[model samples]
Target: MNDHDGPTPGNLVATVRAVLPSLTPAAQAIARLILEDPAMVARSTITEFSAVSGTSEATIVRTARALGFAGYSQLRFALAAAVAREEPERLVPGDLGPDDPLTDVIAKVTRAESEALADTAAQLNPDRLGTVVEAMVAARRVDVYGVGASGVVAVDMAQKLMRIGRPGHAFADAHLALTSAALMGQGDVAVGVSCTGETPDVIAPMQLAHKGGATTVAITNNPRSSLAELADHVLVSAGRETAFRPGALASRISQLLIVDCIFVGIAQRTFETSQAAVRATRSALDEYMADTRRRNK
Candidate 1:
C-alpha cells in the first residue's frame, strides 16, 4: 500500500503468490481460486468466478486491482496468456504425503526448483535488473543485507562482487547490518535480500541505507512488500513452497539465480577488471589447495 510499484502481468501465478500475504480474506479466496485453476478462471465469466470463489463481484474486482490488474477483464486476459504459455512438461508439485517415496520427493523438489527458476525468469524485468547492475558497478562500496536463509544469499552475492574487484560487505547480524548501513552515503549501494520482503532485520538496514543517501535495491518475491517500497529498484524472484519445505529450498534457488544474473551483468560491464580479479583470487587459493593435498598424501 506504500509507493511501491505493482506486480508485472507476465507471470500471474508468481504475482498471486507474491501478494498473497497482503490480500484481504475475501480477495484471498478469489486469489486461491485462480491459483488453483488458472485455466478455468481464464474461461469463467465474472458471475461464474464469483460463484466459484464464494465472493461478491466487487471483491473480485478488488482482488484483480490488488494484483496490479486494471480489473477482472485485464486479470482474465493475463491469466489466459499465462495458461497459454504454460508448458506441458512443466511439473507442479502437489502436497507431499508422509508416505511418499524418496524418488517422488526428489522429483517433486527438483520440479519445484525448476519451475521457480523458469517463472522468475519470465517475470523479471530486464530494465530494472540493468539499472541495478549499473548502480552497483558505479558504487563506491556495496553493502548486502539479509537474515535467516537469505543471509547466505547475501554473503554469496558479496563474494561474487568482491571477486570482480568490487568492494562489498555482507551482514547477517541485525546490529552489524544497521551499523554498516549507517556509514553508507551517496555513491554506495545497499542490497536487501529477503524472500518475504517483510523481515524487519533486513528492512531496517535498507531503510537506514536509503536515508543515508545510498541507492537501495530489493531482491524479493513481493514487488509491493515493505522493502520494495523503500528500494530504488526491485528485482523479484518466484517460488512455490509446500508446507513441509516452507521457504527453504525453492526460494534459495530462485534468489541464487537472480544473484547470478546481477553478478554476470556487473562482470560483463567490467570485463577486463573482473577477469583479472577472478584470476588473482583463484591464484591466491592455490597455496591452500597445495597444502591440503600434501597433508592428505
Candidate 2:
C-alpha cells in the first residue's frame, strides 16, 4: 500500500492543491482528478483510474501514499471516514466544550457545518440523484422504510411527500413494513433509510419491495452496505465518526437535506398537482386537529 496522512485522497483535495505548486506535473494531474470529485476516484479501480487521470499506476500509488494512506484500499477507507464525518449537522452557535470559550465553540461549529456542506457538495452524484428523482416523480406509490433514528427520517420524508400530493407511507415497525412492501408492485418506488445501511428491518422491506417490481432507493452513509446493494439506486450522505461523538444528529441532518432536495425536485416537476395536494393535506390536518381539540375539551 502506498503510505502517506490527513484523511483520504479526496478529503485532502484542498491540502493537495495547497501543495500543488510544489508537485510534479504528473502528480498535479492525479491530484486534479481526486480534487475534482473524490467519489469518482473512490468508484474507480486502480488500473481504470490511472488511465483516466493520465498518470501511471506507480504515480497513483505515490499519490495515495502522499495522501497518508497505506495504499489504495486504505485511501478508499479514509475517504469513507471523511464522508462519514461530514454526515452530521453543523454545530450550533455555542456548542463547543466547556473548556472552550464561547467564541471557540462558535468557530468550531461554524467550521464543522462549512466542512459538511463542502463534503456533501463534493460527494453528491447529480446523475444518480436525477435518476431517483425521475423514479419518484413517475411512481404509482411510494413507501419509505427505516429503523430507529433512520425511521424518523423516513417518516419525515413521508410527511413531506404527502404534502406534495404523493401517496407515500413510512413504517417504523418491521413486520408491517414488510407487509407494506408486499403491497408494492411495478411502477411504485420504495426508499430505505439506514445510516449504517445494515438494519434488517429496513433491508427486509426494501428487498421485498424490489422483488415486487418496485424501484428501490437506499439513502445511507455506507454505500457498500447490504441495503445499498439491494437498491436500484443509492443516495450517499456525508457523515463523521469520532470516539466520543454520536452519529444521530449530524447523520440525520445530512439525510434530511437529501430528502428535502428530492421532495422539492418532485414538487417542481408536478407543481400544480403538488399545490392541490398541499391544500388537501392542510384541510385534512385542520379537521383532525379540531376533532382532537373538541374531544379534549
TM-score, per-candidate, Cα-based: 0.92, 0.64
Candidate 1, RMSD to the unseen true structure: 2.4
Question: How well is each residue in 159-191 modelled by candidate 1, as lDDT tens digits?
Answer: 999888999899999999999999999999999
lDDT of 2: 0.73
Clashes of each: 0, 14
Model 2: how far residue 88 lies from native, Å: 18
Off by over 4 Å in 2: 1-110, 283-297
Q: Which candidate is the best by lDDT?
A: 1
Per-candidate Cα lDDT values, in order, are 0.85, 0.73
What TM-score would candidate 2 get against the native?
0.64
